[model samples]
Target: MAGQKGDPVMVDERRFTSFADGETSLELHGLTFENGTDALAVYGNGVFTRDAAGRAALAAVVDVLRRAVAALDEAGPAAQALPDGDGRGDGATSVANPFG
Candidate 1:
């Protein structure tokens, strides 16, 4: 976990993979911005085997995500707003079909 120490990790946008699983009830994706950067998004509940290593790994993932969120917060509201285009070129600001 690169953000374990509360430091923001600069992850490349190209490494993202769209993921969804009904069994685990979880989804992971990368929301790309018009500026060509992407943000990782994890949604819904997650299930993992109960074990010490699993716990530690989950903690690390949480730490990294927290750091990323904190960094975004520090960037202020302008940085938080969605970039232009919305990837559809229809001038839509909100998500049209998130599950698709």
Candidate 2:
């Protein structure tokens, strides 16, 4: 997200990719601000269970996401997300959580 390093940006696309081994490892893919510029990836180690600390961190993150979703309904990606360039604002969302 080098181009998005300055101003606050949003994800335009997101999905998850998993390994064929069915292990507890997965990837989170996100295209930020615009397509073909930069990306954001979050990896989760399924092999490792979440400790108290990890759970706490995840809880905090979820809380913030909740707040942002409530506050930035028209702005933030999570609240009003749509597929890249679709531009319909149809409130459709794609989730690829193989972890679950």
Indicate which candidate wins on TM-score.
1
Query: What C-alpha root-mean-square deviation, in Å, does candidate 2 show against the real structure?
Result: 13.1
Report every candidate's CA lDDT.
0.42, 0.33
lDDT computed for candidate 2: 0.33
Q: What is the Cα root-mean-square deviation between model 1 and the actual structure?
A: 10.4
Model 1 C-alpha lDDT per residue in residues 5-67, reported as the tens digit of each score: 235333343221112111221222222211112433444555544898668656645654666
Candidate 2 error regions (>4 Å): 1-49, 73-100
| Collision pairs in model 2 | 24-46
The window of 10 residues in a row where model 2 has the poorest summed lDDT is: 28-37
TM-score for each predicted model, relative to the true structure: 0.38, 0.27
Best by lDDT: 1
